[model samples]
Target: MAKITGETRLENVLVYMANMGRELIVADRCTVWLIDEAKQEVYTTVAHGVREIRIPAGTGLVGHAIASGEPIIIEDAYLDPRHNPDNDRKTGYVSKSIITIPFRNNDGTVIGAYQAINKMTETAKFTSKDMELLSLAASYAGKSLESVMLHQEIVDTQREIIATMGEIGEMRSKETGNHVKRVAEYSYVLALALGLSPKEAELLRTVSPMHDIGKVGIPDAVLNKPGKLTDEEYEIIKSHTRIGRQLLKGSRRELLRAASIVAEQHHEKWDGGGYPNGLKGEEIHVYGRITAVADVFDALSAERVYKAAWPLERIERLFREERGKHFDPAVVDAFFAKLPQLLDIRERLTDKG
Candidate 1:
C-alpha cells in the first residue's frame, strides 16, 4: 500500500482512479462528479482528459447514476437513449462507449457519480473491477462533501436562534412597536457616523436593542401608563434601567456586556441629573451615551400607548433643544447630520401592522 500524504490525497485519488479505468480497458477520459444534494446537481470534481461539467440530476448518464444510485455501462453512445450528445458537442470531443458509477457515503447515501468516456485502446465498457474501484473512490468523495454540508447546517441553526431571540424581545413590548429593531438600526448608523469601526458598529447594533429589555420586568401599569405618572410611579418606572442592567449582568460575551451597560446607563443625563447612579458627562459608558440618543430619538418619533408620535420637525427641534442637557454634544451632532438617512429608514419601516 502507498503512503497517503495530506497535500496530494485528492490528486493521488483521482490519478489512481484514472489508472484503474485504463487498466480495466475502459475509457481514458475519466472524470469524477460530486453530487451537491442541496443544489440537486452533479458537478465534475476531477477530470482526466474531459473538461469538468455540471448537469442537473437525471439529465445525462452521470445524472442517471446519481438518480438511480446504480452503475451504468453504455457500449454504444449513439444507440443508448440515456446518452447525452450535448456534452461532447460542448467540449468538442467525440463520444464513444461510456461508463458511470454511483459514489455513496459511509452511510450508503449516494453523494455523486463517476464517468469515463472514450477508451484509449478498446471499447469504453466498465468491468466488475472498474465498478468496484470507482465505487470506493466515490465513497471517499461523498463523505467529505457531507461533512461540509453538516457544518453549514450548524451555522445556519445558530443564526436562526439569534433571529428568534430578537423577535421574542420585539413581541414583549407592545408599547414599543419594534422599538428594539429600530434602536438597533439607529445605533448601528450612529456608531458608523461617529467614526467607529465597522465591527464596533455591528456590536453596538446587536447590543443596543437590549437596552429596554428590562422593561420586561416592569409592571404593565407602569410600562403602559397613558398619562403623566405621580412622583412615586415615576420612581418605580425609573427602576427599569436598573432591572435591565441586572438581567444582563456578568455575561462574558462582549455584545451582552455592552447591552448591560446600555441598559443601566442609557437613562443617565449629560448634566448628571438622570437616574440609576447619575453618572456625569463622559463618565457614563460610551455605549450608554450612544443608546441614550438613539432610544430618545426613536421614542419621540414612534407612537406608543403612552404618547402620540411626535412629528419629524418636533423630534428634530427636541434634539436641538436638549443637545447639551439630555444628549452628549458630539452624539447630538452625529444624530442631526444623519437625520435624512434616519427618516428614510423610518419611512421604509413604518409600523403598518
Candidate 2:
C-alpha cells in the first residue's frame, strides 16, 4: 500500500520501490530503471552506491528484461553474456546471483525493470519465493509510476503555458524578448538568498514570468508611450496591476495563486506609498515583494521603447537608496548578496534587437 499510495514525486517513488525490493528479496543491491522511449535509453537514480546511470535500451540484463517483457533469474550472472559488467568493473563489485523483473503500465506496455544483485541468503542464489516476491513488487509499482509520470507531464505543460502567457504580455507592451526571462531568474536567485527552500525558490522562478501578465489588457497607446505620461495616463498605466491580478485571481491553482499575488502587489511600495492596494512592508506577500525588486531592476537595466537602459552603477545606487523606503530591506540585501549571479543571468538572457 505504501508503494502505491501517497507518493507523487518520481524520485521518491523510485527510492521507495528500490529499497522495498532490495529488503524483500534480501539482495546486496537493487536498481530501478525507467525507460526513456524518446531517447531510447534506460536510466536509474536509485541504484546502490551509484550516482546515476543511463544506458542504451536493451543493452544489459535489466534492459533485456524490459525489452523482452519477462523476468529472468541468474544463478551466476558472470556466466550470462547478456549481463553488462561495466558497472561492476568500475565499482569493483562482482556480480553473482541476480534477478531481473520487468514492470508495465496499465496498458500492459513494458515501462521499466527492477534488478537485484547478489542474494544475501546462505544459498547466495535467488529461489522461487524470491522471484515471486520481486514480481509482485514490480506489478504493484507499475501503476503508481505511471500516475506520477502523468502528473509531472501535466505540471510541465501548465508551466509552459504560464511562461508563454508571460511572453505574450511582454510582446503586447512592445517590451519584447528576454525581459521576463531575466526577471524570472532574478526572482529565483533573490528567493534563495532570502533563505527560501530550493523547491519554493524554483516555484517562484516558474511563476515570476507572469508578473506582468496584466499588461496584456492595457491599451497600446498607454503601453507603448515613449514619453513621460500625463498624470491620467500614469494612473491608467498603474491599472495593469489590478488587471493582471484579476486575470489570474480566479484560478485556485497554487501557481496561479502565487502569480496573482505577484501581479497585484509587485507595484506596491514598502512604506505604504504604492498604488492599487498600498500594502506596506511584510503585509505584502513575499512573492510580490521579491518580484518588485526583480521587475524594477530588469526594467531599469534593460533598454525599453521609452528609455535607454540605465548603467549598472546607477541601477545599483538606486536600489541602495530605495532599500527601506521603496523596497523591502531584506529583499534589497538579497539582491546585493546575489549580485554576481543576477548579473550573469542578465548577461546571458540580455535582450537582442
Best by TM-score: 2
Model 2 clash pairs? none
Q: Candidate 1's residue-wise lDDT over 1-353, tens digit each?
A: 13221223454555554555454454667776777778788787777766667788787888887899888876678888888788678877787777787867668878766687765555346566666766665565556545544654654554354334545555565743467677778888899999999878987886776777676777778666778888988888788888878887996756567778888999999999887998889998778888999889888888777788898888889889988898898899999999888777777766775
How well does candidate 2 score on lDDT at residue 215? 90
The list of candidate 2 runs beyond 4 A from truth reads 1-4, 86-93
Model 1 clashing residue pairs (backbone) = none
lDDT of 2 by residue, 149-232 (tens): 898887788799889999999999888659889999999999999999998899899999898898988899998999999999
Query: In model 2, which range of ten residues has the least summed lDDT?
Result: 1-10
Local accuracy by lDDT, each model: 0.74, 0.90
RMSD of 2: 2.2
- Which RMSD does model 1 reach against the true structure? 9.0
